[model samples]
Structure formats: C-alpha cells, structure tokens
Target: MTVLGEPRTADERRTPDRRGAVDGGAWRARARRWWPAAWGAVLGAVLFAVAHRAMPDDALISLSFARNLAEHGQWALTTGIEVHTATSPLNIWLLAALHLLTGGHAFLAAGALLAITLAATALWLRDLGGDRVALLGTALLASSPLLGSAVGLETYLAVAVLVGLVRYAADGRWLPAGVLLGAAVLTRPDLLAAALVALLVLLPGAPRLWRALPVGLAVALPWHLFAWWRFGSAWPHTVPIKGNGRGWFDGSFYLWNSWPDFFLVSFTGVTVVALATAAGGLAGAAWSLWTRRWVPVALAAGAVVHFAALGLSHAPPMMYYAGPPIGALAVALVLAADTVRWGWIVPAGLVAAGVAVSVLHGPGWADGLAPVRQNWATNPEYEAIARDLPTDGVVYSSTEIGALAFYCQDRGCTVVDGVLADPGRVDQRWVAPWRAERPWTALNYRHYRPPAPIPARWRLEMGPAEPRPGDWPITRAPGVHQVARLVPEG
Candidate 1:
C-alpha cells in the first residue's frame, strides 16, 4: 500500500474504476428492467392513498355489512333484523375479515383491500406481457376518474380478478382461469359474460379448456344456492332496489357513452377513453382477423362484451363497472401496436394527459378526505347525524342511510329504512325463468316480530338532493338533512 500522499499506480487506479463501471452498468440495467414496474408501484400507492379517504354512499353500504359481520357475528345490518342488500358476497367477506384484522377500522380495511388488489393486478399483467403491460394497464386504470372514485367498492377486487382471468387464459391454465371467472361473477354477477368471452376468443384451439366449465360452476353455484336457501332469493335485493339505468344499449350510445370519466372531473378525460376504445377495438379486431393474433381480439372482445352486458341489463353506467373494460382496451391497444416501441406512446400520452390535468388542477389528490363527488353528503355531516340520533328505538332515513346506519350501529339504536337498513318486503310474486320456476325472495318479518311493532321514534328527512344529476326538476338545494321526532300513527 502506498502512503496517503503518494499517487497510486495506473493498475490500481484502473481497478477501482473498472469495478465502479461494472457496478454502475449493473444498476443501470436493473433500473431499465424495472422501470415499468415502477409505474405499477406508483399506481398502487395512488390507489391506497385515495381508497380510504372518501367513498360514495353505496360503498358504505358494503362496509356496514362487513362491520355487522365482523363485530356482531351476524349478517343483519342492525339488531333483530337480517338484510340481503349488500351486493357482493366476496367484497363483504374480504372487508369483514380485514375489518376484524384492522381492529374495527372500516376505512383502513378498504384501503388495505385497494393495495392488495393493485398488487395482484400488477403481478397478473406482468405475467401476461412483462412489466410494460403492467405499467400500461395500471396507468390506464389509475388515470381513470371512475376507478379512483370507486375505491371502496368491489370494483378494485373485480378488476384484479379479471386481470388474473386474462393472464390464466393467456397461459391456457383453464382450471384456474375458470376459478377466476367464478370469482369475477361473485364480484358482480354481470362480469360472467366478460369472463366467458375472454376465454372463448383467447383460446379457441384448446378443446380441453372445456374442463373450466364444471369447475367454475362448482365454485360459483354454492354461493348462489346458499343465498337462495338462506336469504330466500338467489338474486341480490339490490337488483330491484337500485336504479336500472338509461336505455342506452344502442350503437350510437356505445360509441360515446361506454367510458365517460373525465380526468380530475374535467371535460378533458370524458371522451378520451371512449374514443380510444372504439379505435383500439376496431384495430385489435382487424389484426386478429388478418394475422390470427387473438390476444388483441380477446382483450377487445372482453371490453365490448362487458359493456354490452351492462347495457342489456340496463345497469347504471357506474364508472366502477366501466373501468375494468377501459383497462382491458388500453392494454389491447399497446399489444396490438404496429411497433412495440411506439405502440405505448399514444396510450401513454393519454395517461400523461390525465396526470398532467390533475397536476394542473391541483389540491385534489393531495388530500384523501373528500368522498366521491357522487355522495349525498360529506363524511362529517353523516357522523354528526349518527352522533345526534336517539340512543334507542327505530330511526328512519329517507336520504343516505348507508353511512348513517354504519355509524349508528353501536349506539344501541336500530336503524331501519324502506331502502336499506332493513330488508323491507318482497310482495307475493312468481316468475318463470325459461322453463323453470325459482323462489323469488325470502320474506323476512324481522320488523314485525313479537314486541314487534317498533314505532319510528325519529324520521331522518332530507330534500331529494337536487333530484339526481340529470333528472327532471330540482326541487330543493343539496345538503338538506334533519331529524324530526315522529308521532305513532293510530
């Protein structure tokens, strides 16, 4: 070794330099390889950030069920009653399990779910077409205004399931693919169509893929069968209770209305994704027809079939439902690109546009305290109402009962609603499905049981909230909630 002041030989100098160069090269290589996954991490972080911050009134409905299940070991939303209003069984179960795990913090459980599903989605996309596919797909999803607003719903879980379905189908892993398909249906029964279309178009060459059929039935049928036996109807009570949506199944509507979420609630992102879907779908279909490249075709068809299913069912054009297909189309566009290097440019540009708009808009993503714009009232307002409600007897709410019921659960107060908190009533009716008759609903008399006639002690009244965004005349200003002590009717 030379003294500190002495200059080292050229060999010694080159040795450290060479090692530095080699390490630098390796690190650079790793960065290059994982750059795409970096975007996925960004997506997950963004999702987790917003998920628990605020959610729509509908989301709290699910959480209420989870809370009831977790805390009381019962399926009823309130004591002395059982309701079947929560739409997704899997969402309820997942949320309930997480709810207990998190020591009864409801929103934290939702945030946890959002992160978990984002990771699952990223992994599945990476499996399908390396990290770039994950990057492109998650970016498309993250940029959407709809999915961000639907953080606490089954949308995130459903998306992760669908992405996994696509991956398994691409791999010819039909058994697992079928299981995912079943889970997809349980996430929202409407997703079954998308699941079938993805598998059929993606792998028509595999005859053994038929094995998926029986396995999927085994997984999904049990839940439906149990709901029928236990709840008196296989269909969600929500089927009839919620809005059936607009008559928008036409070609013209499909072209413009399928995906309408704007970036940062601006008009910029409104039709951007819709147009991309049309152009990308046509291109993907054409490519599949000409070159037998069915991957693009499968993606396009899955998106199309999902929207079609939603349209035919007159399902509300909820962004949560629209988001998964938007993601599928975005991925298809990238994969169907004429040149791998540039195919991502256009879709990536749209993503950039979304992020840019949000950045320009400012202050929105910085806080997670605002619920979705579609909410009936702010979280604090709901909490205040729950806090002020009477500690006992029945309380009725005509507006925004989900959060009210959830917050009021531990108050020794029984919240009942014609809309939710209680499973109101199913009239005497019968309908035939094809050639078979099915049990329409379970008639529960919880509200009328012995010591039964629980008179409404208070009525939580509120204005119609501007008659819903695009509906007819606006009768009253928004945010009108109050409690009135009710008198028993003779």
Candidate 2:
C-alpha cells in the first residue's frame, strides 16, 4: 500500500539504523559478534559426544553426585552418609542445575555445560586476541585429547572462567574479573595460583585493583565456610585422598600428557618434550612482554605458576588435572605467533611438532572426541559392572568406585576400602597430612574407613591374569576384570 521510496511514519516502518524496528544490520552485527562462539559450540558439541562414549570412570563420580543431588536433595553419592568426594563444587552444582532444568541425565547436562562454556570461552578469546588468534586458541582446546578425556569434569568450566577472568582483567574491568576469579577457585581450587599469576602479570600499574581481592574472596568464601561447617574440612575429601603425592602434576607428567603417547614416554622422550616446551614457552613469554600482548604473557605465566606450585608441593599429578594449565599454554603458544628474527624458530618448531604428532595421533583429535588410549577404561564397561553390583549389600570395590556407585544408584550402599569415603571424620586428626594419613596401624591415625571384612559375599578387584567365566571385559582396556563372589565372612 506504500510507495517503495517513500519515507514511513512512526506508526509504520523504522529505518535500518533506528532502534525501533527489525533491522538487518543489527542482526548482522550480532551475528558478526557471535560467529566465533558458534564455531566454538560446534567444536565443543562434537568433542563432548566423543568424550561421552569413552567417559572416564572417575568422571562419573561427580556425575553421580550431581544426579543424586538433583534427585535426592542430598550431596552424598550413596544414601544416608554425606561425603565430600567431589573436588569441584561448581561442576557438580552446574550439572545438578542442568539436570533439574532439562530433566536429562548427568552426562547430557555435562555436554550442554561443555558446549556453553566453550562457546563463552571462544567469544572471550576473540575479545582478548583478534579473530584469527581466537580461532586458533579454540582449535587447540577442541583438539586436545586430554581435554576430550576430561569431559564431565570441572576443567571445561574452570578454563572458561579463567579465560573470562583474564579477558576482564586485561580490559581493566576489575569487578567482573574478581567475580570470575572467585568462580575459578570454586571450580578448581588449584587454579588459585594461576589466577594470582595472571593478575600480577596483567596489572603491573593498574590502580584500584585492591577491590578485586575482596570481591573474589566474598564470592568464594561462603562455600568454604559452609563446607567446613558441615564436612569438618574446608576442602573436598579428595585433598586428603590424593594430595601431596609426588610426580603427579610435575613437568614429566605434563609433557607426557601434552604429546601423544608414542611421541613421548621414555626418559629421553620426556626430556626432549620438556625442553621443547620450555623453549616455546620462553619465546612466547618474551614476545608477549616485548609486544605488550598482555593476554599471552598472562596465560604463559599462569601455566608456569600452576606447574611450579603443584610440582613444588609434591602433589599427586592425576591425569585429569592437566587441562587448565596445558590449555593456557596452548593458547599462549598459538597467540604468540612468530617473533622478530630467529626467535620465530622456536615457536615454529614447537607448532610443527605438535601438529605433526596430532595428525598422526588418529581420530581422537580429528573428530574432536575423547581418545581411546591403550590402558584406561571408560563408561559403558564401568556402567555394566555398576549395574551388576547388588545395591542391597556393601559392594567393596578397591579399584574403580566412581562409575560403580553412579550405576549402582548410590545410597552410601557401595563402600570402597579407600579413604575417599572415610565415615564421619568429624573428630579425626591427620598423623601425616601429606599422604592422607594412610597406613593406619603404623601412622598412628584412626580415621575410620568403611571396613570390608575378608571373604565377603562380593569382592571386586582389578581382576585375574586372564579372562574367565563371569568376567566382564572393560572395552576400553585390554585386561582381565571380573567380580568374584566369596562365602560370607560372618
């Protein structure tokens, strides 16, 4: 009814640049601002599917906690007794919220969380670095087999929070940065060192930064306080279970994880990978400092600080713990690019080696899914054992309890002979805090373990030398595994 060239009245149509009506430019602008995140989401969703297939047995531990928390209003994996085995409060809570909101399983919740966080991470990285660098960083994260293996865990969430913290801190937005800093700690307390290092490096002369500390503490304090009040400790039960053991998070361990297994395993391989890594890091740090590329430098500093802290403390370096630092290092390396002169050689060599190894590493990195390594076991196999377990009796599993408890539909029913479920340590004192007060008789500690008497009705171990009847094949692993039934000790 209107002429094509005529101007429209206020009641009619608005111009493209105006705020009133549907505008193509606005949508284009939004799409431009968000395309990187879409790329990241696609990458994340694909990887999550892969990880879900081979989801580690340990990862299901937290998934179960989340499921039980959502369904039962209790923090315990098993019923009755409340335990603090979940190391990441934020991870479980996020999973719980996702589970409740969508009425889906915990793994589904985890996959959704992974995609969202990675998308957020990509957008932040875009803001911190330019589009090309951001995409590279995202690729590095999405391609890592280690992160793929760490699905259903806090690593994805913490990395996203860490990236946001770095982004805000670099942009001089102290308040939001502080909030993310606290979230990082809550997600993975070990990230504290990384946060401090990033802040110190990024804020050499920034003013009014003191407010960030108080805000961060405010955000993170209440949970620790509540935990201490209820669980008799401020940290997760895992701190005692695996903390202070040596060689877990050290340089050799990091190197081993960074490269493909065939590329580096022996002492010579470890040494070469370590040296190459150190050289690449130093070059990146130098270039970042010289060019005032604050994010890359901050990222590198975080990796160094975390590795040093864990290594110096002789902390047990579990494989799952490598994600954040390794991820940070990867981002830094990709962002650093070529330095002036001969310095480019180091980063180039590093990049070349990593890419070559990854290309040869197979579909794990290619499809952006979890790697099926030689020895470790994963989801379905563990779930099979868990379903096979009798919930009526105390099924004592010494090796893999996480997937078992989750599948057994936890109720404090399946107790392992491990310190992870030390029943009621309300008044307990550590004899040797480093080793989790293990070796009770000689260590002079009485932190009570859920006792499993010998010759019980069910004994689940790592299994016999070879497969026999009643043996369950851990599809992810090449070994004998079968639950044995014995005469009741009573």
Top model number, TM-score: 2
Model 2: what TM-score?
Answer: 0.78
Tens digits of lDDT, candidate 2, 235-254 = 76566544433333343543
Model 2 residue 384 CA deviation in Å:
1.5
RMSD of each: 10.7, 8.7
> TM-score per candidate, in order?
0.76, 0.78
Best by lDDT: 2
Error of 2 at 225 (Å): 0.5
Cα lDDT tens digits for candidate 1, 398-457: 556776777787666667766555554312111112113323222422222212234566
Q: Could you tell me the lDDT of residue 299 within candidate 2?
A: 81
Q: Any runs in candidate 1 off by more than 4 Å, and if so which?
A: 1-42, 242-289, 360-372, 425-455, 464-490
